[model samples]
Target: MTYTHASPEHGAPERADDVDDVARILQPDGTRVSDPALDRWISDLPPHELRALHRDMVLTRRLDTEGVALQRQGQLALWAPCRGQEAVQVATAHALAAGDLVFPSYREHGVLLARGARPADFVLAWRGEEHSAYDHAALGVAPVQIIIGAQALHATGWAMGAQRDRSTDVAVAYFGDGATSQGDVNEAMVFASSFRAPVVFVCSNNQWAISEPVTVQARHPIAGRAPGFGIPSMRVDGNDALACLAAMRWALDHARRGEGPAFIEAVTYRLGPHTTSDDPTRYRDADEVERWSRRDPLARLEAYLRDAGVLDDSGLAEVARAADAFAAEVRAACIGAVTRDPASVFDHVYAEPHAPLERQRAEYVDYLDGFSR
Candidate 1:
């Protein structure tokens, strides 16, 4: 099987690089900033919608934490954490309509959760039960593509087909900083730009490609790379929920209007190891972690909510209780998940039976029967 890691993807070299300012919609203090257009966008949202965004962020973070804990405890063989990057996933997901499909990297639990995927189903893949517990067609999401940067190609192709179908549906590809270095990503951007495909590429630049620093991949910000490919791009504070949501809205609109692909680089930090398999202490320093903690999206949004009268102490408590309960249910489901049947391995491989597969299955069954249960 192919190894998958958490990340968020890139193309064009014929055009001049026009990347400059990264748009910001929410200040660190929760105050609105940046373009008046973005300000108006947020103003148009109901207060309840704003609160729901915060709620999604909090719960998604909780799910990330739970997944990490389960992995550490040996409940999961491995896991890719989305801990510090909740706002990037959650806020962007909130901006998508039900019909808009997402081609996500392996670490998009926040996006799936915001799209109403069951918490238990989210953990099923990491638990090694099956490839995916969630249905792709039903959820308007593809299976979390484990091959780095492959989803970009898938999204671009999907967008091309959607355009032909005269469908309003948009396709999104989410990957990490490292994926920008991959050729598949660059090629995907080229196709999307050439076809004017309704695709949006989101790069969650958490500053680490596994253990390597993102600085090693590019000296300039990742967003800057998109302009060279003839794609308009935006960079935003990934930890800022409002900024993430606003940027996504801007990109979605541009793409839906058949303006072609848009790229967003959400600058943030991954507060945890790249995966449960990684030892971050060997690479990242404690000071760096602490620095990111101060900018924790959850805390920033919470402070904003309290000051803006969107949430009070009681409201916060309710969010906490709900998240905790949901997390527990996820844990229980993981623990109680049925073990994969060895015989079932032959299933889902092909739509039809073949001689080789049948022979292999027969041999496997015979071998199994020879053993004492």
Candidate 2:
């Protein structure tokens, strides 16, 4: 079921149908807008809690910008910019409990940050020095998956394991709009629903999958696909920090209560290129970027904070200072990543080496020794 609100700008029906669409809490202009039911949820949250949410959004954006800068400086091989989707990562991650495990696609640096994953470890993989930087046991965050939708299966399987142990802890899988096209993601939804696993599937629908628009992935809204897999779903304004938090909290509550999996498709935009490699201007228009810029998540959240008296000019300045310091630390960490030893490549290939690999390793060592002489 969907709800339709008349467009405040045109006075015409903003949305013709609401079959799979969901209402948003914060409007593009920074007004505290929301559906009656969801409004109560946010209204009930403490003011201090709300301010923290805003802070996370600010820091996440800074980290994303610094990441892109690192890529340009040749500190990292590549970077995936989440320039416009800070709210989705921050709000959703804040909703999760410590017991929950999070499986993230490569772009979910914000989620990793919220999960207490060190920024230094998060960037090491991108710096081409390590495949995974954090110990999963310590952070409860799996290594960033580069194979797109594959992490969804890992999340679902983990949730199934938790169910067998009779644990109420849930699992959350983060993926992009483009990942919806992958078969493993579909299979994950199937298994989660069939076994009633406690999982939340978060689709950060940033409109563009690399250069391809979401239209190429789905004929209707992506949220509509949830019903087919027997999972309830909602679409929230990805740029609205408050709404994203409320929607995520709702989904997390449902999953932890043993209500099975839930899906959240955050309707947002990718304000930058797909990564450092691609130029968006070739396929998308500059005007489109300008249009989304007006709806900037950081600006909207600041407006709300000012209206609530939780943030003044001094508070804003402090946040900026904090962000600058954090960015500098990240830059330093990237520059100081340790170089791997030449023989380290074969160290972790096997706990008990097989005959074929042992033979290959011996030959490779001999070849390298010959070069040294």
Highest lDDT scorer: 1
143-231, model 2: which lDDT tens digit per residue?
Answer: 78999899999999999999999998999999998999999999999999999999999999888889888877676678778888989
- lDDT per residue for candidate 1 within 304-346, as digits (tens), equals 8888888999999999999999899999999999987777889
TM-score of each: 0.92, 0.92
Cα RMSD for candidates in order:
6.0, 3.3
Q: What 10-residue stretch in candidate 2 is worst by lDDT?
A: 13-22
Question: Model 2: how far is 161 from its true place, Å?
Answer: 0.5
Off by over 4 Å in 1: 1-21, 369-373
